[model samples]
Target: MPDPSTLTPVDRSGGVRMADVSQKSDSARTAVAFGRIHLGEEAFQRVRDHDINKGDVLTTAQIAGIMGAKETSKLIPLCHDVMINGVEVDFTFNEEKEAIDIRAFTKSFGVTGVEMEALTAVSVAALTIYDMCKSVTKDIRIGDVHLRAKTGGQSGNWKSEVSAEEPAQN
Candidate 1:
């Protein structure tokens, strides 16, 4: 026997497999993730004023984020395809830092937590903004993608010690 107690994500054959959540009980789970895209001053103005040629950046990105959350399992290998109960994507324009902050909240009533889904939402939202405004400025940078908090599952609730500071208006 391969010592069931010591079984890891990889089997004896050395192949990666999704974690088996079959034994886990159904529970309400929620996760929040955040990210930001630094768009230079001129580009930021265009986005803030909705003057971008591509269209409404925030609205389009929000929709993309929700879609991304639902499709997380397809994009990330080994992630379970759980039924997401809800997904919310919000954006805040930070004039002081010349960046747009993205926050994604995901909820599920399933065995696995929705942390990955929340993260995917933030990442895709940032990417969508980049894609929409790349013509205006290739200098845009996407950074600070992180999981802010998570609740439920076997581990219970947890929060990140690094708090995100709101950007001040110019």
Candidate 2:
């Protein structure tokens, strides 16, 4: 890993500042992140049965995920205003844990990577789940947000596929 001193901090003045993307080349960058929202059995069933009070959990969360990617700059203090080309979110069930696995894939034709956007997507989606199910289950948690893989940019392609045994928590 590069030394911390060698890397430039975003806010040199102890405030907020966006990255300088001007010198970087525009590439077809893509990143995939995975996260989990640990809903109790009751909450999971409520989502499965389409009985959540606010609305459809999966659909609404999916839309929120996409919107999250687009609006990442507005949320994260130092993230760049990226031009995202695509964003996809998938949710599945973990029978053993009785929870949901959310995977977000984000693509951009820009100078910076969209890993943050991907992570933000998962975060917002999980939050949406908690929001929609709050009435039914107050114990819902949004957890284990991570980047599974990232492609393009100076670092090239990188991947980290966590084992199934080490489940995400939230």
Candidate 3:
């Protein structure tokens, strides 16, 4: 993934303005992102057993994530309103880490890429898990958020060499 610092700020060139993609032809684009939420033993079990008082943690989080991806344009200013063709949010239980592993995939055919949407999906999914499981434990920690891969854009295809499954201690 490109360093966030390397990305052009909205106001970096001249005055603030949305980048023009009008001349760029629409193309199939997709982005995948990953995130994790660490939970205490009790909380993890409650989630796995669907014993949370807030209801099915994974299902609820999945839905919230898709919705979040759809709302990415509104959440982040300057993002072109790309029509998302599909969105998927899947979760895995990492027993060793005692964490819920989140993966989000977003698809779109547009001049702009759907990287932000994919990222937003993972973020909202992690946040949803934290929200629904907060009552059981407050130590819930969300981290290791990063884009795994992206395709179809002027920048071309790319994948991160670093694994996003583990959160950095810092």
Candidate 4:
């Protein structure tokens, strides 16, 4: 293994450094992240049937996902703050597992990838689901959170190795 010192710091001056976006041209960037909250059948039915006392769980979660994306930098240290062009949150019901699948897509025209933002959105949204459904299903477990894809920047484009079992969705 190589010595850790062999790798140069982002800034040789040893001072805190933001990415050097000055030289890079602005380009459209996007990222997708996935997450799931496994719920008991009773809780799933409440969400599926719009019977939750808090109203629509899916809608609430979707909005939470977007807000989470915007507040990513605040939630995760070391993440850069960037203007978000757009964010989309999709929710799907899995009858077999009695769970809610969450996918967050975020876009921006900036120097940094939205990977953290995408992931944060799904995580917060999953937590929101648990908060809303805890009354009926205290055992709900958040699971399978991962990035699906990202695009733009100097590296061009990138797509995550998402499995066929949970294909990327709109």
Best by TM-score: 1
lDDT of 4 by residue, 138-157 (tens): 98999899888889988877
lDDT of 1: 0.91
Model 3 CA deviation exceeding 4 Å by range: 1-14, 164-170
Better of 1 and 2 by lDDT: 1
Q: Give the Å shift of residue 28 in candidate 2.
A: 1.0
Error of 2 at 99 (Å): 0.9
Question: What does each candidate score in C-alpha RMSD?
Answer: 3.7, 3.2, 4.6, 2.6
Structural similarity to truth (TM-score) of each candidate:
0.92, 0.89, 0.89, 0.87
Q: What are the lDDT figures for the candidates, one per model?
A: 0.91, 0.86, 0.88, 0.85
Per-residue lDDT of model 3, residues 80-103, tens digit only: 898999999998888998998898
Q: Which candidate do you rate higher for lDDT, 1 or 4? A: 1
Between which residue pairs do clashes occur in model 4? none
- Candidate 1, residue 11: Cα displacement in angstroms equals 1.2
lDDT of 4: 0.85
Model 1, residue 14: C-alpha shift (Å): 2.9
- TM for candidate 1 is 0.92
lDDT of 2 by residue, 26-125 (tens): 9999999988888999988889989887888999999999999999989988778999999999898766666789999999998999999999999999
- TM-score computed on alpha carbons, candidate 4: 0.87
